[model samples]
Target: MGALDFISDYFSISTRRKKRKAMQTVDIKVKMDCDGCERRVKNAVSNLKGVKSVNVNRKQSRVTVSGYVDPNRVLNKVKSTGKRAEFWPYVPYNLVAYPYVAQAYDKRAPPGFVKNVVQALPSPNAPDEKLTTLFSDENPNACSIM
Candidate 1:
């Protein structure tokens, strides 16, 4: 075969492999109040073994985790953080949580609310401030789900 043909075939095989390896998405209902809390939720869930990405919408009170993973593990992971979490029972067929591309951040309290929060709070990751450290999953072997 020609060089171009060989390259095309090779790339197609690799692309298919990558697509097949893509992780599943599971959304979990989370309890989050503010930007800092949202950051903590994302940080915690993103550290999981099979987790690809985590998006937390505090205003909506939802956390969506996209990864080739199960809801139970994610639920357990969130609960470990002192927050109450469950697969959203509101969904029909008992869906864990409704999946969606996370939407806009609307801190739509009255005007000047967020600005006041910024002024009232310290800078992100301030040296003296303590941040929540997420726990490593109990099973280290599952991390290779890439």
Candidate 2:
């Protein structure tokens, strides 16, 4: 029985099957000039296997796809419709520390949102540096130590 179990584990059929994709939501940025463009983009993504829903916001040029699908495949499908497309790169302005930094700020982004870029994130040492400055002798405003 032990030998049989070992052989069965070694030749497991489950290993040959493709792993199933987990549920996920993918947000894409696509410029749609009209209703036809919106419909085209929506239909292209909805027809994909495992896609549960698609929401298109033409005003923001954003398309949200929800299902068990790969993000790259979704982006490619949108691009196939003859529209320039890319993954959503912006995050809510309030979520970022330096949202107004040159690399993160964008005039084209919808209101209350800013581009997500490394340059816009606060440095890991920022808090420590602030503490050091607050206690430094050169800072007249710093509290005097006994």
Candidate 3:
């Protein structure tokens, strides 16, 4: 009986260590319109146990929370503040061009999606070299008054 008790105690300690999960970071997309919305989300997430920090980006509508916490728990806490929340989904624009990559080009992409490439356009300040109109300055009928 004494030998059995010693073995059980050793197993219990190992089990406890295994159950402890490492700290993780979670990013969630939450649409915040004003300062008040940002405050509400920050306050709600900070209250959760094991939360070390909460960062909110109003421009990007993103909230990042870090600590030894379960992602689902943090998400639920933010949702409780009367705001819609979902895990942040990010995909690079370059990857979108290659449909062969299974992960990059998903049919479930967010709405109003556009590539991140820069578009080149003719400068409005540049002067036109030639005019194709019949009313050009050099044309004889340019001025009917003449």
Please tell me which predicted candidate would have the highest TM-score against the true structure: 2
Candidate whose lDDT is highest = 2
> What is candidate 1's lDDT per residue for 5-26, written digit by digit as tens?
9999889888764334357777
Q: Write the per-residue lDDT of candidate 3 for residues 1-146, one digit (tens) a residue.
A: 99999999989977775455678999898999999999999999999988999999888788999999999999999999999999887545544553334444445444433233333443445565234344577778768834
Sort by lDDT, best first: 2, 3, 1
The regions of model 2 sitting more than 4 angstroms off are 1-16, 120-146
Write down the TM-score for model 1: 0.45
1 or 3, greater by lDDT: 3
Q: How many pairs collide in each candidate, listed in order?
A: 3, 0, 0
Report the lDDT of model 3 for residue 138. 72
Compute each candidate's TM-score over C-alphas: 0.45, 0.74, 0.56
Q: Give candidate 2's whole-model lDDT.
A: 0.92
